[model samples]
Target: MIDLEEIRIVLVAPSHPGNIGAAARAMKTMGLSRLYLVSPESYPHAEATARASGADDVLARALVCQDLDEALRGVTLVLGTSARARSLEWPTIPPRQAAERINAESGGEAAIVFGRERSGLTNSELERCHYRVHIPANPEYSSLNLAAAVQLLCYELALAAEAGPVDDPTPAISEEDPREAYAEQIEVERFYVHLEAALAEIEFLDRENPRQLMRRLKRLFNRTRLLRTEVNLLRGILTAAQRQAKLARGG
Candidate 1:
């Protein structure tokens, strides 16, 4: 059985009171009752109560903390939301992947950190997190509202916890298969290399102005975390295309 009490939703310096209330409602809807408000702009506001709807109990029981450190006192695992990639190297995972990790570590207390509505989490705040989570979205418009992000993440965690750990009933097929899985970033990098090579061969990449294009491409593929099979499929297509091009040129 899953323990909802092990999870805590932490809001850091929330600027809008209504978002706070709405987030609380979202948490409650997902069977997550614990809420920690870290230096919110305003508490006990009418907007918050109105937005909270019937989740007043969540707000009432919320722990108000002066800072994020205080709010994360006993948390064994911390997940922070970021819309953009940071310079610092941190294990970045999608909401669903993070949820799986959280479910596996169910015995320990965990916290999901949501930043202010406008600017989102700062570099300093993100540094405090052990894991960084970003919701998959269209690169053209990836900005997600604070409450919406919270709702999506909370929903994923709830679903993952309820489903329990992934059950692999099949016995080991080969001795080559490692006991652990590769990190998401390593998988992404392999896919990106294949994708970039394909694009270059097709003469699609602009050699003169490839800066923005690569960044946009990264955003596009990073959202999906292409599976090993998917990556192989894409590479195969590239190989076929290259062969066809060479044959045509020779003829």
Candidate 2:
């Protein structure tokens, strides 16, 4: 059985204590147990207890922390919820995708963070998260309540759990076969060399006045975090360009 103990729902600076209680109830309905609160306005109140609706147990066992970092402590993965897309870049994935990732990574402690009801998570708070999860809603009006968002995420997670872990059908390659490398495993030096060579061949990087060409190119490629196939393709293109250049120079 996929243990719900590994998953935690974190509320940051929740304005309404009743919403917190309701969120606890929603989480319990989906079999999620852990609840972490980061500086809630007023917890353990009569209103919160009343709103819990027989789910006060969830609230009772919830962890209360002073700040976001304190609540996030010992959590290997953190996901932040957002309704509107922000100008700043963050790793954004749909709810389904996020659920799959969470299930796969449930071996470690993980938490899904929801912000205040009024304003939602700020850009800085979103930046603290490893990934951003956005629930799909009607494009015309997509405002989701705190409890609703928690319900949707918990539902997706439960569905994912029922569906079972996703399998990679592709057989592992033998030593003789070309092993595919993940983006993290690819050598940065090789990419730099390939890029520099390609740029030189194209006369894009002038030696006389190379103001910021290389730096810009480096930033661009680094952003991509190129996978094995992408790196190989780039190197191939650079090799072809070099060959063409050599032929032109009468090599």
Query: All models: lDDT?
Result: 0.74, 0.74
TM-scores for all candidates: the values are 0.65, 0.66
Worst 10 residues of 2 by lDDT: 168-177
Q: Give me the runs in candidate 2 sitting further than 4 Å from their true place.
A: 167-251
Model 2, residue 191: C-alpha shift (Å): 25
Rate residue 90 of model 1 by lDDT: 53
Q: Which candidate wins on TM-score?
A: 2
Clashes found in each candidate (C-alpha, N, C closer than 3 A): 0, 0
Residue by residue across 1-251, what tens digits does model 1's lDDT show?
Answer: 23677688999999889998999899999989999999999997899899999999999999999988788775645788888776544568899988887776523367899888778787656655657898899999988878888899989988997887764222222224432222233344555576667676667887677645655565554344344455667668878876776676683
Where model 1 places Cα greater than 4 Å from the true spot, the runs are 166-251
lDDT of 2 by residue, 32-64 (tens): 989999989998788888888998999999999
**Candidate 1 Cα lDDT to native:** 0.74
